[model samples]
Target: MPAGYSLHDFSFDLRQHMAPANVWVTSGWTSVVAAPGTVCGVGGCFAPPYAAPDSSLSVTLEVDGRELRDGVRAGIAGFGLGLLTSGGTWRPDRIERSGTFHQYDDGRLVSLGVHSRLTPVHGAGGYVLEITVENRADRDAEISIHPRLSAGQPGRLPLADWGWMAPRAGDLVAAASTSMTLRHDLLHSRVPAGGRTRFTLAVELGEAVEPGEAARPGATEPDPADRARQATDRWARRLATALDAFPRLETDIPGLAAYWHRSIASGLVCLWDNPGFVTTPFVATSGVDGGALCAYVWDTGGYAPHLLTLMLGETATDLLEAMLKADLTKHYAIAPDGTGLGVAYAYSGWSLVTLATAVASQRGLARGLVERLHDAVAALDARFPAVGELRDYGTQHNLLEMRGAGWEHVVASPNAERAAYLDALATLAEASGAVLPVDALRATAHRIRASIADELWDAEAKWFRSRYPDGHTELTYSVQAFDALRAGACTPQMAADLIARVRPGAFLGAYGVSSVSAEDERHYELGDTDWSGGGAYTGEAPQLALTLWERGEAELAWTVLSRLLWMGEHYPYFPQEHYSDRPAAPPVGRRANIIAGLAGAEAILLGLVGVRPRPDGGLVISPPPAPGNVALRGLRFRGRSIDVECTPHGFSVTVDGRRIAPEGGAVVVPAA
Candidate 1:
């Protein structure tokens, strides 16, 4: 295969699929062991979870002494292999991708492909490459291939130490990536016209195999192809069971429906489930960037946990609660080993509380845990406080640090966030049947909400602005306002004024919502592509759409959501941030697999689907109006299976099997 092949070239779907090149298929767990489209080979991996990415072990192919260049197509599931005919018709069925496709030898077609499977969950051992040759002519094809694995630093092994492979008893050599190359495989295939034969090479890593106990790739041991398929099927089943049963999103939009599944797959890749790894269910920020192996509090603060809670239930809670091992009072992200990474970020405190509440209110958490989280927030409140008392949330960088330094802390969103979290926690505490101070927490929340309008409201601009340390209001427009709006910080008039500004050339852009208003030349000029000027934080696009929908801007919400469809159609998953096209600055965004696009699921569930778990152990489901026929099937909520469909008139909701027409789009499914 040519190095020019894109991610779309090797996509093979499992369970469900989309158009080829729309999704990437590889060995289940985020395909961590697989190559980056295999065009460059598997350089980036989540395995060994934190193994730093190095150069890729390159792969190439040839047939009858001539290099194969064209006529390659991806598998049906998107990861399998296929070839093209002279008439340009794609012939597909067998699997794997990358390497060369040699055209013909004396009018006989010869093609090569490999389906690879690496060291499974442990991430420590070797890998296997199934290199196959398909002869598409009347006479049998004779082939001899010797692939030397040469790199900057090839492990200086003695001739006796070289690993071996079979029917011709080949030798495997080590490269820079510790990759073993196939060599001296001179096998005259017994294949006839249109016949295909396999060359299964089993490789053992130098570090994984014992000197005397090493297994050799001798005489095609026990039909390896059949065994590989069975193992892959087992993996697929295990992964399907790892997550909670999610509601399938069916939509008229091209890739929107499949995006829901793709988003979940992205989250699956973030997990580091090696038996001996740090935590059993730990998650890294990116599936590809080996350097990013922590679950960022700021990212969790966004829509990640909301979707996680919805999908994995308390499992998601456990992963997040593990993050609390870090001294949250001073840091914002936590590694698998319990070390906090970033500085004391602005959103850490509430982000923790929000994570707790997402599960506490849904599946139910222990009373002791809920009480501890409440006290933790109280501690944060005492140290940081809200905008009214401290002029900031502990003077730390926030989600939108692009505006300016310390500017994140100066924002007015935390006050509302604090009030909202406290209210939810208070209710959660009561539900757990262990409440120490319900009235006090509610009273405090009430006071904070009142203070937001009294202190931060800019009557002149009819919006809210940050109160600088000097107690002067600075006029600015950014995505932060959307957070304040979600927290119920805006009055009817204030919300109308703030949301109306969400249009093109302002907060809203072609890609998504801008981090700051483009109209603010002075402030915007100071920012770059990392959620600042001329950049769209990829996660925010789906979220802004949800916010707009919830705030009753149905038409506008659809516009934003529709524009964000580019995410699923383009990349395998939503990236951290969408950089500007014009003479852009460096890609200063987080290593992806950030699970930012998870907000798309959140928007659908909470905003458009309008499924909210009430504090009183009931559900307030109000499916919002959507374009075309939209149905959410098999939604497992609070131990209840709920299916919701949007009709021309209101919505059709089903609990278990009986259908109920919500009077005003409000149906109360009692809490489990």
Candidate 2:
């Protein structure tokens, strides 16, 4: 009865408000149909794949005063039935051979009878329905109905379009995203003697339609595109369900909001699947479910804090403590003099910086924890004293380890900058106005920054290079270079030069920057075994663009952001990783993918106008400086309802009807 309410939410056919149109197919497969019960003994139904047996079934329904639009079709794909994209072929797993439909209305009340079942593979949700017939006669009853879900655009490919697709031969993506919706109808069959027929279809329990609300009219058919978009709304409900699976986080509500808000803030950095993992916190794009089992992680130390710091401040402290306990024993088996070890192990140390900083921020220097953190920082400085790129740590347990090994360390390392960035942990040491060992960490960070500028910066190459034991630099521009810029350790010219070098090749692909520079031959290696291994290795392009923008490269950053989104629109769904070479690889799974994580988080939390808690107990409404025509309307922030209009002229914020002072340079309001 309300906007955005669905049968899954209110047990009613909210489709009643949709506009009338043609049959449609979403992404492909899922179908909806509409029909009148007056003569055809038919009503309406939403159908999905059935379970147990190999056939599809309609979840039956009956409505009163409901305009049953024609039948429609749709599809669902990508990570846990979320991340839906329009256009695809949906072949019937199987069709129901026999079924029944009936409708009866007693003034204000209505009843509908139907039976059907269908099954879909890899589909978790299932559908169910049962009805009894009293008549002893059988007849061929033709249900007058239209397939609202199978409709196409004014000029679009038909449902059978995929029949012509070449399997992975080339891009199987549609020419463009389709815009459509779905409507469904009742299924009919025979009347048997005192017998009841039971039917089942795959469906989420939350989306089941209520018996009484089934026939209430006003359901209209939309194109397939509209329907696919509708399916994505199901993700939040699914997220709620998935949350039920996890034990309630042991943290206060305010703390919990802070934690989620931190994650939400990180999401603003990029709109790709980099469910931030490793040391850097949420990568704005590359991260997933916290803890060790995250997807494609690198530098978890830098990635983890981005997720924990803003919220659950105490919990963040606990997380750091936990990592110290778990990782120290496994990843940091280094000797005191930092000698005789075959390789370098830094992920634990990198992450420890985030942990120590988080703890010091909350508890201050008086807590003995600061000493332990200082000790850890001291160890890191002692271990990788030279400040070159780090190597992959090693393999431990089931997941790939990040213990920084031998000469292998020079390749694909996230060292130096990560360590320097993590050294910001020292700032928390000043919490009590007491001098801390923080200065030691700051000095170490400064040393690494200076070393990078002196040795790693290749003036001829115009970017930072990976220094190797062979005394040759890997002449390539790296996002790791951007990390140094973000650390505020790089000089302005260095940052500008880094941006200049990144504009060429895969680093500036159709999406955003690639983790590996395109000019480097080793960037696209495919293998069953290697440190980088296979699967999704490249970072989402939007993330690199965001880093550039954050570093003040606005125009070039916008160019990359637009291209990455454009590439996203062409995929099966917003992939966790896109092929730097092929923009249309039927996106990989969504676990720990930063792109989806960042995009979804940004759309709701930041693009909608973000709220961050300031140390002084107020909120900061810093809207993202996203390129293109970015706007935030109906944004709700602390102390007032507000909206932000951003342009090249900078940003302006309005609260209620009054323009507030952004004069503070950042929008700060007292904490709620």
Give the number of the best model, judged by TM-score: 1
lDDT of 2 by residue, 1-672 (tens): 012212122111112211112111111122222121111111112121111111222222222224232122232321112111111111112111122223232333222233222221111122222122223223222222222122221122221121111112122222333222222323343434443333222222112233332211234423222333334443333223212211111212122222222223223222111111222221222311111112111233344333234333333454454344332423332111111112335445555665455344333334455556655555554554343423322232212231232212342234454545446555655543434566766776676567656766667766666555655544543445565565565677777776776665645555344555555564433331112212223233444544655555656755654554433222211334444444433222222223232332232233223334332234566655534333344433223455556644466666666777785556766535
Poorest 10 consecutive residues by lDDT, candidate 2: 19-28
Model 1 score (lDDT): 0.56
lDDT of 1 by residue, 160-272 (tens): 12111110112223335453333323434565656776665433333332333223434233334443454355444435554445676776757676566556656655665
Candidate 1: residue 251 lDDT (0-100): 69
TM-score of 1: 0.79
Local distance difference test scores for all models: 0.56, 0.34
Clashes of each: 13, 111
